[model samples]
Target: MTKTDQSSAIPLDTTARLPAVTYVLTFCIAVIGSNSLVLGPIAPEVARSLGTSVALVMSASAAFGLGTAASALLMARHVDRLGARRMLLGALLGLAAALALSALAPAVPALALTQLAAGVASGIALPAIYAGAAAVAPPGRESRTIGVVLTGWTLSMVAGVSLSALVADLVHWRAVYAVVALLAFGAFATLKTSRYRDAPAAGSAPWPLAALRIGGVKPLLVACAAFMSAFYGIYGYLGDHLHSALGEPVSANGIVALVYGIGFGAAALLDGVVDRLGARRVMPFAFLAVAAVYLGFALAGGSFAFVLVITFLWGLSNHFGLNVLIMRLAAIDPARRGTIMGLNSAVTYLAVFAGTTGFGPLYASQGFEMAALAALVLMLVAAAAGSWRLPASATPRN
Candidate 1:
C-alpha cells in the first residue's frame, strides 16, 4: 500500500465495529443529498405556493447547483487547513440556516437565493464528509466504508424524495424544507457531539491547480466528468419521457426512482469485490457496465417493465462506478484529498448542469432514444478514460 493510503487507514482490532462517527457522517451526507434532490419532486407545489411558473422554481435548483460548483472550486481547499470536522460542523450549521430560510421564502427569487446559500454550504460539507469517511475507514476496507456512506444517496432518493413529496401533498411545500432543516440540525448536533476528529494534513497544496498536477488526477477527473454528465443528461428528462411518450403516471415515475434507489443501496453488498480486486483494476469494467445499461435504456425505452428492470441495473452499475472512482481519488494523495474531492464535486455538479441543458435540444428534436444513445456515447468515453494506464508513480495503490 502507498504511504498515503496507510496514513488514512484506521488500525482496528478484529471484530471491532466501525466508529460511531462513520454513521454520523453518513447521516450528514444523507441530509446534504436530500437538499440537492428534494427540489425536483416538489417543484410544482413550490411554484404553486410562490405563485410562479414551474420552470422558475426549477431554476432555483439550477442556482443551487451553480453555487455548489462555485463554492467547491473556490473554498474546498480550506478543509485541509481547518480540518474536516470543524469545516463540516460550520457548513452543516450554514446549511440548516439556509434550509430554514428556504422554508420561509415567499417568492421565487427568495427561494432561489436560499437554495444558493444551501448549495454553498453543501459544496464545503460534501468534501469534508468524503475526507472524513476515508479518514475513519479501517485498513483494507476503504471501498466498503465509502460505499456505506454513499448509500446515503440511495436514502435520499427513496426516503427523502418520496417523503418530501408526500409531505408537500399532505401539508405544504414549505414543510419539506422545514423538515430538512430540522434534519440538518440533528445531523449537526450529532456530529458536534461525536468523537471524530480529522486533523489537517501537513504540507498539503494550497491551490486546486496543484491537485490537478498530481499524477493520475486528470484522467480520473475526466472519467468522472463523463460519467456524471451522462447520468444527469439521461435522468433529467427520463420522467418527462415516461409521461409524454409512454403515458405513465407521475406515481409510476416515482416507482422507477424507488426501484433504482433500492438497487443502488443493494449494490453496497458488492463493495467488498472492489476492495479485493483493487479499484484501478475494476473501474474500467464498471464504466463499461454503465455504458451497457445506457444502451439498454435506448432499446427498452418503450416498455415500462423493461425500463424498470434496466433502471435497476443502471443503479447497480452506477454505484460500483462511483464507489471505485471515489476510492481511487481518495487514495491518490492523502494531503490533497479535500481538494481532489472538491474537484470531483465541482465536476459532478457542472456535469449535472451540462447534461440537463445539453440533452434538452436532442430530446426535443429526436426523442428519448436519441438522448439515451448520447448518454451511451458519453459513458463509452468514460470507460476509455478509466482504462488509461497510468505510470507506476501516478497509479493509486488500491
Candidate 2:
C-alpha cells in the first residue's frame, strides 16, 4: 500500500486524548517482562522438578534470549505489513500458549523449547506495543505515554519477581508460568475488545536493512546497546555480591529491588519534562545520570544502606535514559517504527546476553566494585552516543 493510503487507514481520534487501551498495553508488557525474568528466581525449583542441573535450567533463559533476538531481527518487519493490533493479538495468543506449554513441559528440553517460543512471541509483541502506544498518543503526550508503558518493567521487577518466588515456594515453580499465561490471556482479551484503533503500517521498503540507513538510527541503537548491557551486567551479579561480599541476606536484595522499582515507577511522573524538552536534548544528560549512578555503586559497594540508596537512584536515572531512547527512536521515522523498534529490541536482548556473559569473569575475579566500574564506562559510552546529532526531521515534536 502507498504511504498516503496507509496513513488514511488509521482512524484519528477527534478528542486527542490517550486511549484506554494504553493501560492494557502496559499490562501486556508487564506479563511479557515477567516471563523474561521469572526463570532467574525459579531456576532451582525448575531444575529439581525436571531432574536437571541449575545451570541447565538457566540455559533455557539463554535460549529464550537467543530466540527473541533472532525473531526480532527477522520477524519485526511484519508489523508494518500486518498492522500493530493484529500483530499484537497474534503475538499475545502465541505467548499465552507458549507459557502454558512451559508450565506443562515434562522435561528440561521441553521447557527450554517452550520458553524459546514465548521469546519469539515476545519479540514481536514488544515492538507492536511500542508502535501502538506511539500511534494512539495525542500530540505533546508521546513521551508521557511511552513512560507510562515503561513502568511495566517496574511491575515485573517488583510484583512479578516477588510473586513468582512466593508461588514457587508455596505452590510450585510451574504455577508461576501458569499465572503469567493467564495474565497474558487477560491482556489479550482487554486489547481485543478495547476501542483503540490500529495504526496502519507506513513503511514500504524492505525494513531490516532499510531502517539502518535512516538518518539518526545507528547512534541511538549504539546508545541502546551500551545502556542495556551496562544495566544487565551489573544487575546479573548484584544479588551474589550482596550475599558474598556484604554478608547480607536474600531479603536485603529483595529490599533493594523494591526500592529500585519504586524509583523507576515514580520517574514516570516526570516524563512530561521530556515531552517538553524533546528526547534529543534530554538523552545525553539522562545517560550521564546513569553513569553517575554506576559510579555511586562502585563507591558504595560495601555499605548496605548506601547500596539501597544508590539502587534507587540507579532505577530513577535508568528510567529516564530508557524513556528518552525509546521516545527518540519512535520519533525518528514513523513509517519505519516497527522495524526500528524491532532492531531496538534485538539489540536489547543481545545486550542482556552480552552483559551477563561478558561481566561474569570480571565480576568473579575483580568483584562487584570492578563490575560497577565497567558499567560506568559503558554508560559513559552511551552518554557519548546519545550526544550524536540527529536530522532535524527526526526530532520529536515538543
Candidate 3:
C-alpha cells in the first residue's frame, strides 16, 4: 500500500466536508450516462429521421464511443496542461455545442461528427471527475463514495432512456437531443464557477507515450477493455433488440432502461455490502452471474418480465468489475493517476465502440440471439482474464 501526505497532495482546505464537489462530479457522471441513454432509446426513430438504416444510426453511437476512447490519450495531455476545472468547463461547453449540432444535423455524417465531439468531451471530463473524487473523498469511504458517484449513471440511464423514449413516442426523436443540449449548457454553467483543484503535475511524457514505457499498466488495461467490450455490447444495442425481439419498438426502450437502471442502482448501493463481504469473493461470482444473464438475454425476448429480470442482473454485475478495478488502481502510485485513468477510459470506450458498432450489424442481420451469445462469450473471456490479472493486493478479503 502507498501513502501520501494529505496536507501536500489534496488541494482544498481540509476543514469542511467536500459537499458540492461530490455532487458536481456525480452530476457529470450522470451527464455522460445520460448521453448514452438518450441515443439508445431514440435510435430507431433517429434512424428513420436521418433516412438511414438502424445499423447506420447505431454507428453514431459507435463514432461517439470510438471518439471518446481515442481522445482520452490526447485529453490527458490537455488535462495535465490546462488543469481539471478548465478542461471540464471546456468539455462541457463542447458537449453542449455538439448536442446542439446533433439536434440540427442535416445528415447522418454530421450527427456522427457531433456525437464524436461529445465523445471527446465525455472521455476527458469523466476520468478527471473521478480523479477529483479520489482526491477529496473522506478516508475509509473511497469505495462507497465511488459507488455513490456511479449511482448518477444509473439515475441518468433510467431517467434519460425512459423519459427520452416517452418523448420520442409522444413528440419527435429530435426532442431528446434538444433536451440534452439544454442540460449540458446548464451543467456547464454550474461547474464553471465552482472551485476545484487540478492534480499536482508530474513531469512526464504524454499519456500515450508514457503508457508505452509502462509495463504494469498493460494487464489492467487489457482486463478493462475486455470487461467494457462485453458491458457495452449488451447495453448499447439493447433498444434495437427490444424492437426486433419483443416487437415493442416505442415503449420497450423505456421499460428496458428502467429495468437496467434499477438493477445498476441496486447493485451500486450493494457495493458497501460487497465491501463487507469482500470484493474478490463477491466480484467473481458477479461476473459468472452476469454471464448467465447474458445467456438469459439470448433467451429473454419471449417474455417482457423475463427481459426485466435479466437486464437487472446484467446491470448489477457490470459495476462489480468496474468498481473493483478502480479501487485497485487508486491504490497504485498517485503520480500515475492520470495515465492509469486515461488508459482505463480509453480501453473501456474502445470496448464501447466495438460492442455498439460491431454488434449492431450482427444483431440486425444475424438476429438478437446470436448477438446475445456473442456478449456472453465476451463476458466469459473477461471473467477468465480478470481472474488472472487482478492483483492479489487488490483482491477483497473474504
Best by lDDT: 1
Angstrom error at residue 231, model 3: 2.3
116-211 per-residue lDDT for model 3 (tens digits) = 999998888876766666656665455566777778888798788678877888988888888888888888888877776565556753556575
* Model 3 Cα shift for residue 325 (angstroms): 2.2
Query: In candidate 2, how many Å is residue 84 off?
Result: 0.8
Give lDDT: candidate 1, residue 277.
68
Which residue segments of model 1 deviate by more than 4 Å?
1-16
The TM-scores of all predictions, comma-separated, are 0.96, 0.94, 0.82
The alpha-carbon deviation from the true structure for residue 282 of candidate 1, after best TM-score superposition, in angstroms, is 0.8
TM match of model 1 to true structure: 0.96
* Model 3 lDDT, full chain set: 0.71
Assess candidate 1 and give its lDDT.
0.88
Candidate numbers, best lDDT first, in rank order: 1, 2, 3
* Clashing residue pairs, backbone N/CA/C < 3 A, model 2: none
Q: Which 10 consecutive positions of candidate 1 have the poorest summed lDDT? A: 5-14
Off by over 4 Å in 3: 1-18, 43-55, 80-82, 168-174, 212-216, 236-250, 274-283, 298-302, 357-374, 389-398
Residue pairs that clash (backbone atoms under 3 angstroms), model 1:
none
